[model samples]
Target: KLVDYWSDPDRMKQSYRNAVNKAKNKVTTHQGSKSFAQGRHEFVEMKAIQDESSAKTIPPMKDRGILDEVLKSINRYCTQEQFEDLKRQHALEIEEKRKAFESQQKVLKKFVNLFNRQQGTPSSQF
Candidate 1:
């Protein structure tokens, strides 16, 4: 599932832009707060406080039996050899996606650093 996400350059770029926008918006939202105006570290602390206050509590799983049944159904549908081949293919895809994502992140980091330098802004702001 994550491999599918990492495989799409357009989607990744969109997500990156959205994250930057969110960060800008966060700064804007906190502009009136004392901590935000105080310092960068204070702003980070304030954000962490807000995040902790807003964090959701996950509900515990109701049943483990369903998982066993799911595994059984999957095994029932595929031969051992077919399952092994699928697993190998999935692993290869995952590895390829991980490498691709790492390279993309490195390139993006360099580009962002260069852009930040040119704009006379800290990369941490975004």
Candidate 2:
């Protein structure tokens, strides 16, 4: 009977949905697991990277199976109202790159200033 129960397509679907929901915990729409999301994001990011010589300006990335199972689980198990309450979390990853660039500029500026000062100094060994 237990085997027959799971063998039923509808029952199997329901069981799978239940399991997915349990894993999702209270998540409504966003990522289920942080580590899972991070790993998937990294994979997507790597795949999205464009060749240096490519004319494309921006790396394309969207709904790239990063949360396919979670989204499907939500659609199957979650109420529309509850799902609507869930929001995707987005971090400002670009800020880090921009900050690094700014620091490099500061270092370059200091080096240039020192170079100019040395250039202005007369040769002492003459």
Candidate 3:
């Protein structure tokens, strides 16, 4: 019978408390690990985007025909004006992303500073 399992009130309370603590610990650990992994992934993606942008080298005007030929091959239906507009839009998007990333980095830095100050210890020291 179920009564046989929980015949003692004190034992039942202790068991309940133990179960609650275990659940809390599991949830806390899971959340902390998940947040750490997500932050790492975001950092890696941001760095890769920044690296690709920085490594871009604009070809000389004389060699620009190669770029045009490649673009033409891929977009035979697109007009020259449309292609130029596309390039402009792509550049604008990249610039906007860079600005947004910079803003996020600034906010993250401020949060980290406040967190460290509240904890009363430098993160590097830890």
Candidate 4:
């Protein structure tokens, strides 16, 4: 039985792919309608978030089951110094992104102020 199951993994995978494709087509076809589009957008956004969470190298430390077990198993393969280096790298990336966003916000604010001042003219027909 185990051998049979292992041999037929491709068929199982194809079936799942077909089902997902059908669902995606349905969503895209219905997206022109306002309510359906909103619902579909929300569903897609949620799926993206789920995919991101699944792809993360670290899971929350509080869980005690399969996810946590898998994380622990992977951790066993890494040294403490290596893990610390990875953490530091991630922190630096986050800080750089934060700084870039703040700079963009400052530029946008200056543009808004300049536009407002340009429009702050007095009427000539007083």
**Predicted structure 3: clash tally:** 0
Among residues 3 or more apart in sequence or in different chains, the pairs in candidate 1 whose N, CA or C atoms overlap within 3 Å are none
lDDT of each: 0.67, 0.59, 0.67, 0.65
Q: Per model, how many backbone clashes are there? A: 0, 0, 0, 0
Candidate 1: list runs displaced more than 4 Å.
Answer: 1-77
Tell me which of candidates 2 and 3 scores higher on lDDT: 3
Question: Which tens-of-lDDT digit does each residue in 1-126 have in candidate 1?
Answer: 899977799999998998887787544543454453465655465455445445633333223322332224443576565679899999999999999999999999999999999999999998
Model 2: per-residue Cα lDDT over 1-126, one tens digit each: 989987999998998999997888664445446565675665565454433214455543334232342234543565544455453212344667788999999999777777777889533423
Model 2 error, position 103 (Å): 0.5
TM-score of 4: 0.35
Candidate 1 residue 67 Cα shift, in angstroms, is 31
Worst 10 residues of 1 by lDDT: 61-70
- Candidate 2: which stretches are off by over 4 Å? 1-91, 121-126
Question: What is the TM-score of each predicted model, taking all chains together?
Answer: 0.37, 0.27, 0.38, 0.35
lDDT per residue, candidate 4, 13-101, as tens digits? 98789888778764344444557556666666555555556788445232223333332445346656567989999999999999999
Clashes in model 3: which pairs?
none
